[model samples]
Target: MERQLPNFLKNYGSILLLLLGIVVGSIVGGFFPEIVAWLKPLGDIFLNLLFAAVIPLLFFAIASAVANIDGSQKLGRIISTMAGVFLGTVIIAALCTIIVLWFFPVDAPQVAQETADELLQGNPGDTWGDKLVRFVTVDEFYKLLSRENMLAFVIFSFLVGIAAMRSGETGASFRKFLISGNEVMKQLLILIMKIAPIGLGAYFAYQVGTIGPELFGFYAKPLGLYYILGAFYFIVFFSLYAYAAGGKHGVNRFWRNNILPSATAISTCSSIATMPVNLSVAPKMGIPAAVANVVIPLGTTLHKDGSSMSSIVKIYVAFVLIGWDFFDPMTLLTALGITILVSIVAGGIPNGGYIGEMLMISVYGLPTEAIPAVMIIGTLVDPMATLLNATGDNVAAMLVAKFAGARGTLSAADGLNTDDADGTD
Candidate 1:
């Protein structure tokens, strides 16, 4: 216990301090009221600093991780299984958001809408094809470099990584540069995080004091909904998934071993950081080391159920601000597609989904004001997000084990459209 105590504090100390700062600031803002003017600027400065750094950080992180794919992803069958499970789970999470938002719609923040208005004014009548094209790629290379072109940037980074991988020995220097740039961005993120407490505190103060209760309500509704939905999904969906993986025993083993990892994810607010715990617990649940080794590590960056749910909420918040119909069939479908993309890429970019938020902005043409309102949602809901993100990987490993033919693996998909005479199975 003594040995573990230092590690525990080392992991949680910063988070605790940041929470304290937010709490203290909120109380002052709510009661004192007069100090929010100065406090708001501190928050603005922090957010501005964040927005400036994330572009390069996202680029390097995605490109570098993809470049290293040759080493990290060796298990071919397990990779396919993980992909299937990851996408299925995230889609379920997003559909849950759709249902919840229908009953409990979130309103736009009561901040000034003039800027958003100007940006949305004269909404162009571009064809669906043009809109579709712009959603994934920009016409010019320089346009892809900006925050407003996030999806374009993501696609470009992916291509660059794949090109490097395909070039073999000739691309070694470029690969190294990508990795080194990724490391530098990580350090830059660390430097930005060091000021998180003060910035969050200041922002919370201003929000409580002057931004109107509606703005708080703007965040509160989604935050509350997320916890309720997260808990529900964690218990119900995961148990069902475990049962599918290995019947009653799998369910029992998963619950018993999952508590610590769930706790770690919520405390650390990081899927990557919680991965060691998942790796440690996988064997006790009867998951193959091969499955755990592949699923848990790759899942850290590629699988994201929590982010899927939150992405919908974030997009809905923007839709409300823009006066769009959230329940429109086409809009809901578009939201779902974007949610999946965000969940997948969000892990790679880090910084609590700000890059994901940027993706939302670019794809939908959301205005700049949406950034402040939506970026904090990621941080606020991160504990649950990380909880879903991390533990889902563990459960996924179990499923991957089953899919790889560990005792009575689920094979319905293979049976659906195949014939024994074909001999493919």
Candidate 2:
């Protein structure tokens, strides 16, 4: 029985279990709609568990990685490389989304009056200065806990980490403690994931049961096309990036190892939730923990390849719905700039698509009524967007590691091995 149990788990792990749940939930919701509300808590509990761990995990993981850096110069090089890779990928994704929309355009559907009113109520009338301030600093430390201000946390963590690195002997012991704490949090994440099937199954069941029918309605075609394009981009473009970073063998190993993490991202529809899995699996793909620790956490907040694609699609749809002339060169350029900026500020929080939608209204000078239409599109493509976002982060980590000279092993250049008295590699 014991041996059989292990084999059973191996065959029916979280991915299979979550898929099964989605199927079963869809069936149940389709036939018995009354039960979906009751089943929602199962998924909510699971999501809450993952969310609870995200901030601390990010803090310790990033702080430890930075503290281990040999000096500010190496850190500067890695940061620059990471930023370049992130920008290049986002631009490519944005261009792909634009081209796809150009070929297969969507006519915006009329949104219900109630939905428009509800969406408009949350508009903050934010200015560029307000947005910039929010990204760089927060009014209170506790506000950093909110996912909306995650970049602020990244900045704070970097400062703390840099200070620790310069503290000499005292910093070594603190870094070790952080490493230990990060390991503990990772274990906690694994424990939470153990019941993912049960949690996700219930959640998906409620989702499909409630929204399954709607998915086949008017929103189906454009959303469906977005999913197909997203898949293509993820598989082809992401693989190419990986190959560039790690070579054919490295790319092969990455795809081979990341199947489960990809599935996790799809199911949860969150890059933040999938960070634990990404961090855990990165070392196996030849990314040193030091690099993975920094890249994955920062990427979760800053990288938005998937969101860039979705935002482009949403903006295109909005233009069509409102009869705005998007073909004007200056208008097109402005839209592209706004899309990239939105992606940068979108963060790793769940339901962050709305923030992008708000930007669309403010930046494009669209009617507040357009909010509901943009948000509806966002909801439909969120899973695919998140899958792309999470997968891109891992790929970016590989490229960053490669650029930093990580070659299938840990070394000082890779930032995994620090020059400390303990000789900790």
Candidate 3:
């Protein structure tokens, strides 16, 4: 009976939870608007628990992954792959920003003087020098990098992974420990997954009910644009890159092999939670365990293409709201460059979007109140952002796998076999 219960839950849990969150959140939003306040904390608690697990998971997964790389002679290849990822992300960001600016120019709307006066409240960060100083200081820096802090945690985890690779036997033991830890996390996450449906339902219901019909208009156009770009990038840009660089069988098969994991990431919107699936799927696509291990974990923190892109868009919206033209050539160029730079530097931190957007607000001398607007933007665009982010990571892993010359997917005789029927061919 005990064994039967585990199996039953394992099969049906996620569906159950999703329904529960929607029902609960919807009911709360519809009939208990006043009690909606309590539901907010419940949502926050769930997110916080998820956030708490991210940093440690990243640290172990990355270290273990790096330590397991097979080929000593492939260092140059790995570096080249890393370069591809960096360059590809920058290009994607530039393209996204330019396209959005050109197509979806936001018109300024006039609000009452009193309403504008009310919005002029709040302070974001500081002056350039002051913020830069704060950014570089050890304490603030640490806070920035922690998983809860996110950016700092990413930086530290990468350093630790590198150090672990060099530590020889201790590194091996630590790697084993990390692998074990990751498995444990996977089990715990499976448990969490059961409740996720409930949480998602509740959250969405609350959001839809509270925001009401008027809020729908606020997101309509921008959301449309976001989805259009998201699809274009995924289907055209990524597919082209994979095929061009990976060969027909190679890239196509890789995509097929890893679709489930990528889909999971899109649905969950949490890269850290998707790691177990990624690790399992990657090898099927011929990604070496070493490359798979290192790339996916590291990518979670660093390659938030969708998140950062949405952020830049939010700032543009703010500028539009403040009655500034968004397409002034110089302003456009500066915004693109700044978004990419700040996003990269702030990578690996918790809520890097928050920090990056705050930095942008300071840098541009924009009103601090813009943060709430940006937060709304982020929330609305998160699923698409997570999808792009997960896709980017997979592409990065493929490139790395190619460069590493790892054995698995190179043979044509495999005839599109995958580790699992759902994974890359």
Q: What is the TM-score of each candidate against the true structure?
A: 0.85, 0.57, 0.59
lDDT of each: 0.77, 0.69, 0.60
Q: Tell me, by lDDT, which candidate is best.
A: 1
lDDT of 2 by residue, 252-287 (tens): 657866886787787666788788888877776777
Encode model 1's per-residue lDDT on 261-342: one tens digit a residue: 8878876777888889888877666776767878888888888888898888888777776666678898788788888777
**Predicted candidate 3 versus true structure: per-residue lDDT over 49-156, tens digit per residue:** 545554555455455555554455245656567656755675676667667767776544444122445444434666768654443344754464443334345456
For every candidate, C-alpha RMSD to the true structure in Å: 6.7, 10.0, 7.9
Scored by lDDT, model 3 comes in at 0.60
The TM-score, computed over Cα atoms with residue i paired to residue i, of candidate 2 is 0.57
Total backbone clashes of candidate 2, pairs 3 or more residues apart or in separate chains = 2
Q: Using TM-score, rank the candidates from best to worst.
A: 1, 3, 2
Question: Top TM-score: which candidate number?
Answer: 1
State residue 238's C-alpha deviation in candidate 3, in Å.
Answer: 1.9
